[model samples]
Target chain A: MKRLVVMALVGLGLALGIAAADTPTTIRRDGVVLTIPQEKRAEVIGDRLRCLVCQNETVENSQAGLAKQFRGIIRRRVVKGETNQQIIDFMVHRYGIFVLLKPPLIPLTWLLWFSPAIALALGLLVLLLARRRRQQGPPPLSPDEHDRLKELLS
Target chain B: MATMLTRRLMFGLPLVAVAAGGVASYALLERMGRGTYNPQAFNNPLVGHKVPDFSLPGHDGHAGFDQAAIMAQKRPLLVNFFASWCVPCVEEAPYLDAIAKSGLDIWGIAYQDKAAALDLYLAKNGDPYRRLASDAEGRVAINWGVYGVPESFLIAPGGEVRWHTAGPLFPEIIEDQLKPALQRLT
Candidate 1:
């Protein structure tokens, strides 16, 4: 009976340890608690999203309070086992591409997508036009200078 | 006629010089603004200068991870930016834990993760970070020049960022690149 009780206690301890290992801790800061499952996929998702407040920052790097809220939102989605694209799409719908530091290419943002090429073309056109004007113009020479050069040679 | 030609040349020369100077200055300023001229630009070139003041709740839920305290120590440190949802970050997790176990001062900033989920991750995989700061706002990662997850930085005793490796670091990288860099930092 004593041996059985000891064995049962040890087994319970092992079981609890395993459970605790799998149970993720809830990190509470400033007024938010981010709950993440102890898994690999979820970690990646958190890193991919951009922080809305900090324009160039991904959700993972921004310290703005809004970033904390966004992270919480991502963590909830990850816990729900959403696919990466699904998670990203969900945020895109909520906040539009502006929330994404690296916004995906889509039809609605065609102007932003192609403006660089357009700007480059315009710059090249200006350079070519300037060069053409330079080529078309004749070199200036006064009559006296021209006559003096001819007299010197003669 | 010669005097007139000389006068014309003298007046025109200054105008040409001024125009040339103006054009050159504009081009230089444009290049600087676009950041095209500096081929080798650093994100957080300010490392070793001084670590920024960051006071955030730690992963453990009870304490604050102070940047100043971490910098005050003489030991070389490994600072990593990771997220729970990143695939590469998942792959690098165990390795970071291993590095921490090797008696090094390893600190982590959860780039953009929730506090609860981060806790869950550490509980499952094991916490390699002595103290993990939640960069739920990504403010710290930006300061650190982290563009992606699984980026690691090795800081020397004086707080200079000696080495920066971006991406999922492999075991061989640890043996070859990171270990050597850490050795040099110490």
Candidate 2:
């Protein structure tokens, strides 16, 4: 079924204007993980893991010795039919959450994750209050203040 | 009064945030300068967890030890990962020797090294490990969360990983972190 869907997508891409050679199913693109039949799942999982030695490169892109070992382990697990979650969890268990290329949302990262939205909300609130004040115009002047203003205008 | 309060708050909040950020940066810089912290290192998740299953063939002149051996240990010990080709491991030799001389057991795992190189490296530097093994495929090292050679783990009795360091263990580290950690176990 998955193969059928992938085949459909490839057909759709070819119809839409993507070259046959550029399609992911048939040919590997630059920075795309290796395209072996059994390695697709392993490649996806490895793409999210950081290469410790290279630091910036994902395990899929790094040429480091350790990255090669990671590729081996991930391929073995995927071939064994382990779920993607299990593979990612195993890496995290050994290497800590830092091994993840993209940080997961957790209690510690709550502020980091939500701060932009929080700031936007605060700005909209301030704008709403200011507009409300403007719509209300100036407060009704006290009798003495109204008389003084009238005398000054006359 | 309302305007004054608003003005004070507009100035005060950002000032407070900037001050807090400044203080944090200053403290981190000071610790880095003092050699008490490494910015590039992350906490190994295996700490406080049991050592996972692994077995490796014997290497060099020492017999191999496995997870069963680690579980049978009745006292705190060190699992030192070193490679014959790793420069930092050569730098860490004296510290390992010191730890061994202090009567604490050390189990060394040779990472991806040949027998002749291992024999030469140990003989020339000094053999501090009481028992030894080899992780020729690096599978065991990966399980142990070792990112690099010269990393050391302080394991508690029955194989609980207590602490780990990921560089050459200098004298200061041995005295400040490793010794205190061992003392706490005893």
Candidate 3:
């Protein structure tokens, strides 16, 4: 039993060690070194762009083959010394603003960005008005009603 | 009077809240039904842009594909990306053939397909393409922003992408969309 426990512990430790070593710190493809600040520019671009096929996921997180190809395109642009904006423009030109993970805050999207805050503000206003009305306590009972209350108590 | 006002407000506030909520929910449902963020509805950004430069190996006994040569012809062209395995490509092949017969220049980029498979596909579907190129690695298709097979782009005389569709080309699409665009191009 002692030997078995030792072997199990050794196996667990080795598995964890391997997993840690395998954690990717940088992206690579087919032995090409995608390093930054040069390659990091591409990484930033990838994170900002959405995968056309995956819909919900950014190109960086998507496992779709199209996403991988998009990343390759970004890397190539980065290697060619394209500026971040130029690279983004190229992608937007090819795939439209929808390809951007965060749609730009244009007139069309203003409501999307502000509606939550607007709703919260409206709720708070309603709550404050309701609380104020409650705090005022029902308008003090009229004098006649007070006399009637005294008479009933007697 | 104050009590009456307070009572009116109490009832009015809830009534207004419920009405507003109903209106808001209805609007939201309508928007959702319309697919506000639908990727399919998004316009192809390349529509107004020039077709990306590309060169690929030609299949079916055609000469090698060249972008400059195609643009030099100064005629409207249809560039279709397809693969042997894509079902929609098979469905749309006859329509493409019909359009080709109608004197429209249609070219095919066999996306990530082997030459043998492409030859077989063309043989089976009655080759509609004036020239077919093999995009074995799919690099050229990527340049054209093709994420799916059976996507077709209509290039204007100046080599600008004027319109695009992302699915099987049915007769209605050919008659309505492609025909109108072709008419405009001419």
Find the candidate with the highest DockQ and give its number. 2
Model 2, span A1-154: residue lDDT tens: 9999999998898777756565565333232344466576777898999999999999999999999888888877776778989999999999988999988999978998999999999999999999998999977899999999999999
On lDDT, the candidate that comes out on top is 2
Better of 1 and 3 by TM-score: 3
Candidate numbers, best DockQ first, in rank order: 2, 3, 1
Candidate 2 lDDT, B55-94, residue by residue in tens: 8878856889889889999999899999999998998898
Q: Candidates' DockQ values?
A: 0.02, 0.69, 0.57
lDDT of 3: 0.83
Clashing pairs in 3: none
lDDT (Cα, tens digit) per residue for candidate 3, span B71-166: 776789998899998898998888888889899888888888887887788889888888888898877887777778889999988688888988
TM-score against truth, every candidate: 0.43, 0.78, 0.69
Model 1, range B1-186, lDDT digits (tens) per residue? 986997999899999999999998889888656433322223344444566566767766534476776677698888788888778788787878788888887888887787778777778767787767787877666545455677787877756667776676668678877888877765
Better-scoring candidate (lDDT), 1 or 3: 3
| Predicted candidate 1 versus true structure: per-residue lDDT over A106-144, tens digit per residue | 986788889999999999999998799788897677999
True contacts kept of each: 0.00, 0.86, 0.76
Sorted on lDDT, highest at the top, how do the candidates line up? 2, 3, 1
